[model samples]
Target: MNYKTFLINLDRSPQRLADAKKQLDALDMSFERVSAADGSQLTPEERACFDKNTAQKRYHYDLTWGEVGCYLSHLKCWQKIVDEKLDYAIILEDDLHLQDDFNKVPELLEQLKTPWSFIKLGNPFKPRKETPVETLARFNLVRYDKAPSGTCAQVVSYQGAKALLAARSLFFRPVDVDLQWQWEVPIKILGLTPYVAGHNLSFDSDIQQIDQRKNKAKRSGVRLREQLRFFYHSKLRGE
Candidate 1:
């Protein structure tokens, strides 16, 4: 399969980059390292893409700077895919540990005869409901009734990147959560399982830590409101 592979890593996290390099090198996979967008350092133009009012109405809370940066970081990869006109690309966050079967990903994707835009390389959050779409030697490509969480790893096609870019110039939700709104992007989301990648729990997540600190004082009702909004979108709206 002809595709590019990109690993997102913050310049501040050289150790994580090194670790990722070691793992990918051992697997004989080639990838480019994308410097992640640091929330604290977003330029005026980058920060303008974040819509505060929309975030409050849709997510029931303001997105932490970390979340904004995370979203922008993923956007960089998407933009690259569109600009370069690549067939597809495997995008990986620094915190993931790829499985041995990761090499089989190309074969798995090659078997799909139907149209596909995005395919997650790992599982979603708890309570996943998957319908098998196709089976390969080491992975089963499935569609989720419930949209998956986390941008840990995914295979994004040129069309997928174009669709996402056309969806919005301004975003209100986290990148992963935004992906769940297929009604908006109008793209079918798929996944592979058993997962070809898993989180590397050893490395602390700066985004999570920053969010915890920022939302520590958040009201209990905020959590309930967020849940209700998610249900409405995913269940009632069929997003």
Candidate 2:
């Protein structure tokens, strides 16, 4: 399949940048690496969105917001991709690995575009049972077909891109959590099937932690509560 590859890179991580380039090169995948915060190139609208601050009092929550900020800072990157005009694209973070024969995934991409609007090739959870994937408005979550780690990678087609674009206005919160929910809940609510690679196409773990603390999120509760919204109360309140 003919597709364009896009990677989100942060200026702070030189080592990660080098590793990412090496991995993609090894896979023989052509891609474009764009900084998540190169404002000179961003649209006026993109800049304002990233500049908005919710005003948190606690530190951990502030950190969460920062992560969200970092993620949000990349909106223009996605916008640019859409503007450039492509049916679908492979989006990756600064740190991700690929299979030895990853170059042959174009065929899988073609297959993925059929049933689901979007597909995630890399998942943290491994694929076990063959659960049929449902097609959401623009993406699909299906049983593992590729690897074991079910949350390692993701694939999105034009429809998925449209979905993401539609939800773009709704992503004012944390990037990872927003992505997690968008992949799981909204996709499901919209009746899109979500799938995991079941394979290890991407990787992120404790070792990569920018803070190196387990309860960072818990510690963050006090300050970021407002940002989390009312629904989050159920988890915090344990109702």
Best by TM-score: 1
Q: For candidate 2, which ten residues in a row score worst on lDDT?
A: 188-197
Candidate 2 Cα misplacement greater than 4 A, ranges: 38-65, 125-130, 134-152, 170-172, 182-239
lDDT (Cα, 0-100) at 233 in candidate 2: 40
Per-residue alpha-carbon lDDT of candidate 2 for residues 118-167, written as tens digits (9 for 90 to 100): 45555544334344454434444454322232223455556566666666
- Evaluated against the true structure, the overall lDDT of model 2 is 0.49
User: 178-199, model 1: which lDDT tens digit per residue?
Assistant: 8877877767889888988878
Question: Residue 68 error for model 1, in Å?
Answer: 0.5
Instruction: Please give the TM-score that candidate 1 achieves against the real structure.
Output: 0.90
Clashes of each: 0, 37
